[model samples]
Target: MRHRLLALAAGTALLATTACGGQDSPSQEDGELTPLTAGVIPIVDVAPVHLGVEQGIFEAHGIDLTLESSSGGAAIVPGVVSGEFDLGFSNMVSLIIAREQGLPLTTLTNGVTSTGEQGADLGGVFVSGDSDIESAADLESARVAINTLSNIGDTTVRQSVRVAGGDPTGIEFVELPFPDMPAALETGQVDAVWAVEPFGTVIRQAGGREIASNFVDTDPDLSVAAYFTSEQRLAEDPELFASLTAALEESLAYAQDHPDAVREVMTSYTEIDQSVVDALILPRFPSEIDRDSVQTLADLMLEDGVIDAEADLDGLYR
Candidate 1:
């Protein structure tokens, strides 16, 4: 099955805006503050970053942060590489693949971990409740929808199908966005879709049945999301990089302790219902990168022929 994984831009005249609704300004305080541009998708996976902003953690650390919402990692990586974004959210697999392909990016922080229990919260593959797809195996020779090709959603679903004894290569994969999956499924544009967050929850709420959850099939310890920065940013400002980590660490701590508060803050940005927000499975927020977990994803990409080389994992940590 060719997994269709779905899932940034910058300009100045563009003063990067953090989720906190403030403009970032360059700092003169040496290591005290830095004007940083960060990108995120407006999903629960990024709740901690928003929590950090809501709780004043980033501000407390003297960091002027600007956060731009991106549609997918495709946009985020280019922004980071082009110096438009100092750091952005990226999947471990995507980052490793990009780096092996010479994108000059490195993981700065571990963001969210997806588990089977939290599968619906992050995203998953779903079939209409009345459909004949009772298990992932039913997806064989079936039509499937993905947010994008060669992205996290696609790769995740591919793995899920394989584990269920279905040939991932045997399925037809169509590209669609998360918001449109429900209609697509109803209209027979596709039989199923691999999605995250709101869309997954929406499908279930509307009577769609989940055939498989990537989180359940995939290990929870897998690093699904992370913050990444370019080698240029690290070299010019190691202290700034450290500040970003510290800020995110503070955010992660706050988010884990106050899920309600994080949800409240997010309502202003996303259209996801407050009720859905409360019910969603929250991702585990580990502040530091786990090299081993990341390496596993890198190895998978290699097996899939997504990258030309293995990621050089040395010196990948601070």
Candidate 2:
């Protein structure tokens, strides 16, 4: 029983932008409701912010939150830097690369994290059930599919292979949309895929077997993604960011405490099937960023030649 899953394409290409948007200070009009736009990807990872808006958490903090869905961090990073969004959601790798590329940005809060269970994490490298590839090390000469080439997906996958004593250099990474990967794997177009829920769930239900939990292999408490804003935006209104952070923290706690709420909110923003939603392995949403895990990721990135220089960890957070 193959189910068609819909997910915002995670393919990314960071573009340089010089345009600016948003107010110098949060609007004091309409009973002091500040209109803020956030660039986000419409995947399972962003359900907390959606739930926050629905639960009036942002409203309680004097914010009229507007979420603008984009492809992935590739779009969000430039959008946030250009002030097109007051804040944006993205994978940690994108932010680190952006920082190294001279884009001034800082994390507002942690977005999503790994479950820390080897094969039971939210996302993994999966292959067909009947395949001989029983572990990550077998992927040495296999063609793996990842949404983005030089970003987190391939980087963590390579780490998983290396950790499994495989020569990752021979692994060919194919760039495909998340929505297309399941089908590609089913038809043997690629040997494996780095899939995240609810696509991971879909693949499992369709007889795919998870070989490696890349996120967990990278770091047990791997801070996969975060909500971030440009330094200019944070400097423009420190008080506003404080309130926003408070609201976001509250939202994160709420989502963590209420898994049902997170699953419910996912349907509102995406066309994910209800059955798959119920079976989703949701990622952790901690309010505090895992700085050590982030540093580990950065170190791995540097070692893998993903970044030219070491990322400045101090200035990368709020």
lDDT by candidate, in order shown: 0.70, 0.85
Best candidate according to lDDT: 2
For each candidate, give its TM-score against the true structure: 0.86, 0.91
Predicted candidate 2 versus true structure: per-residue lDDT over 1-318, tens digit per residue: 000010111122223232333443343555677888899987889999999999999998888899999877876776776567888999998888877766778998999999999888888999998899999999999999988777899889999999999889899999888889899999999999999888899999899999999999999999999999878777667888888999999999999999999999999988888999999899999989999999999998888888867878888887
Report clash pairs, candidate 2: none
lDDT of 1: 0.70
Relative to the true structure, candidate 1 reaches a TM of: 0.86
After best superposition, candidate 2 residue 82: deviation in angstroms? 1.7
Number of backbone collisions per candidate: 12, 0
